[model samples]
Target: MVDRCSLEKEYILSPELKFKSEIQQLNNLPKAKKEFPRLSEVPSQVLQQTIKQLHKGWEYFQKRGFGAPRFKKFGQFKSLLFPQFQENPVTNLHVKLPKIGAIPINLHRPIPTGFMVKQVRILRKADKWYASISLQCDVSVPDPMPHGHPIGVDVGLEKFLATSDGVLVKPPKFFKQLQSKLKLLQRRLSRKKKRSKNYEKQRLQVARLHHKIDNTRKDFHYKQAHALCDAGDMVFMEDLDYRITAKGMFGKQMLDAAFGQFRSIVKYVCWKRGKFFSTVDAKGTSQQCPECGEEVKKDLSVRIHDCPHCKYKTDRDVAAGQNIRNRGIKLISTVGQMGKETACADELPGAGVIQSRQVSQPRQGKTRKPKK
Candidate 1:
């Protein structure tokens, strides 16, 4: 259907018209016993749902400036949606669909008493079949942690997170640890003939390994995010631009760190728990001295921040955390009363203190004339 719709130039601009035309064509087909037997056997609602999905894809493309919809080949389409489903009358543990019979489901957790299942989507992954059931229920918000401090976190490639309270959290580099095994698997896969049974087996093995790595990373992120949200009432972090940073020399390391995922987890977890979460400009968080507001320029090799003006010294990451905390506090003080959703500024308070003090540059001159 997606392929047929894409071929029509007129349908490219209007998905609704294309959907209606497709439905009309399906309805006008011959009877099941005579011709188009399978088409007639399939439920009308299922066909309509597929057409609705195609239309939705085009709508998304128009609104989000995404690429046009494309045809799904053989195994590419892994999931099928049943918009309407009900509890099986014969079996308590199965769900009845329109055309499909009662399918048994493995309930990992008990569903809430008052919750109602709205839809079910069955998906295939590797050799496993999974069902995703959407439900409607009333959910109560969790209470925020009663006692905790406001913390500023600085996420870095070296350390996963450096907190304002002199704490550092390190990431478990799951991919790096399994790189050798993955490389060996890929090499073995490359040696097999394409489309051969051995090649397919090796491909599945490689995919499972990748999936394991992803799952491990997600597990770590979730645990760390939960810990941070539970320990802090308000959390502040740097608003980093990962895309721009990924084009640099340490692109691989930056991507591996997965700071963006961690930030997202923290943001959502905070929101769900009624904790305050904020992001501050990261421009001078590392360079600017937290105590005296002096700009101390240093390279990445400089792990410690030694401010010449105030004679204050600390770990570079710790200094950055402190600076982030100060800025967050200032932002809250300025905007908290106004009930603003976000606290943002072009520059942190006292950021230009050092720059404003202009010292005269010494030049070579005639010393004799000054003496006379």
Candidate 2:
């Protein structure tokens, strides 16, 4: 369909101006199935969905003014989406799809008590095939109310993350650990003739290694996110575009750390665990002293935060985390009934104002009792 659209004189004149609907009309034509016999093998909805996916890319490109839609090369298209289902297609041990018969699957985790399977997307990663099922439950769950301990988080390439409570996590360079092996595989692959069986086998080996690195990094992110939620009821992170950081000298390390993915996972986990999550302004988080609230300028080389005004010293990341926590608390206090919900007495000052000049004393908050 993309090729056909590209050949159109109007599309060549202004590709950005065209949309998915125009191509969709061609997909609906009876001649489409005649031209592409393979189209008839899959369900009609799946074929239409393929066009929708392309349209989504085109739409995004129009809005972002970059990332124009491009055709997928051979073997690049790896997923088939069955968008809607009249009934649950998943059984105890297999998932049923239209046109395609039941395929046995090792169910990772059972669907929740009330959720109904709504859609299924079958994806291929290297040599493994997997089904990603989406479920729907007709229930409205309110967002977790701001309460209990509020903790701030600061993430970087050096330390995976530092919390306001003085907890530091080191980055686990998953890629770097296996990079040598990956390079070895690529070198072997380059020696093989293109399109040969040996080359294909070698290519799959390399792809699987890359997939392993991705899975390992993502698993680490989830574990860390859960750890953060376990520490505090309210989690606050700095709202910085890690993408900008990814273009710098240490871009490879930044990419390996995957700060943005970690933050997003943290937010999702916080919501799932009935905790409050938010992002505070990222500006000057490192420059301002958490103790005295005075601007103390420092270079990237300076890892320790030393405040002259208050004679306070601590890890720079931890201080930044503290600032993030303070800002988040202030934000909620002004917008909602934070005083009524929050259990901390020291934090309660003149109209929710945090006294940065005073020495902060750590007080053990009442451990939140679980609901019956």
C-alpha lDDT values of all predictions: 0.69, 0.81
Give per-residue lDDT, candidate 2, residue 291: 72
Model 1 global lDDT (CA atoms, 0 to 1) = 0.69
- Candidate 2 lDDT tens digits, 1-372: 244453445324555564438465655755778876987897988877887787788778889998877778778999999999888888889988999989999998888899998889999999899999988999998998776667888988788788887877777889898999999999999999999999999999999999999998998888788877777778899998999999999999999998999889999999999989999999999999987789999999999999999898999999998889888877777635564443232454322323344223332532222122
**TM-score for candidate 1:** 0.72
Give the best candidate by lDDT: 2
**Tens-place lDDT digits, model 1, residues 12-105:** 3554553345555455544432554677666666666777777778778879996888888666777778776456222357767677777787
- Cα deviation at 247, candidate 1, in Å, is 3.6
Best model per TM-score: 2
lDDT measured at residue 2 in model 2 versus the true structure, 0 to 100:
48
Clashing pairs in 2: none
